[model samples]
Target: MKRITVSLLLFLFLVTCSQSDIRHNQDLEDTTYSIVEDKNESVIRLSSLTTFDWEKAFLFSPYSPQEMIEEQLDVDFKDPSDLDMRDDIYLLVFLNKGKVVQYAEIERQDADFSIEGNLTPSNDGINIERY
Candidate 1:
């Protein structure tokens, strides 16, 4: 009787541990995002920004450029007509709660490029930085 009880407790502990690990993995997968180069155009495509719960959070709350790239925008750069298309070009894009878009070009080194910043909304709009 004692051995049987011990074995049952051990099994339960293992099951609990495995369940926790699975939940952790699911959360990691939900938050993962990526950027891929568009082969047809001279542009990069940002992907996986529309996962369910995170999208709702992004649409309602103030987030960073990194968070936006990892959670919200789903734009494709088909025509580089208005863009400078240089390797050194950096852009700050603002998207309002209404989904309106605005942008500004900044002179910065290509090596200094990153997709991280706090993108709080103001009277102007929801602001984000892009490299």
Candidate 2:
């Protein structure tokens, strides 16, 4: 019985851990896939602008951004239950209105995606002050 219990626990641990690796090809994910906006418009898509595959490399690292989600805050933090635990966070870096800014790797299908994640000159980035 003890062996069975230990085996079950170990299996559960491994199962929980493996999900972090799924869909986590960080090179392909991090490498920028340029989306041309137009000439003189000077807009670019930041969805795939990372050169580092922080997701896979940092999945188990203590410094991972997902660590930021587990803590409680006065401000609204996206419920991880609502988000794909497998979803990796990336920086959406681009230039807009002559200022460079970084956005959270947000997908339209993400439950966490909302008007709040949007970066705008008017926001002055006060919204993203937290981790």
Please tell me which predicted candidate would have the highest TM-score against the true structure: 1
Report, for every candidate in turn, its global Cα lDDT versus the true structure: 0.32, 0.31
Instruction: Tell me the tens digit of each residue's lDDT in model 2 across 1-131.
Output: 99999999998887655433333333432332222212222222223344332211111111235335333122222333333344534333223333222223433121121123343333322111121
lDDT of 1 at 87: 38
Ten contiguous residues minimizing lDDT sum, candidate 1: 50-59
* Pairs in steric clash, model 1: none
Q: After superposition, how far is residue 93 of candidate 2 from its true place, in Å?
A: 15
Q: Which candidate has the highest lDDT of all?
A: 1
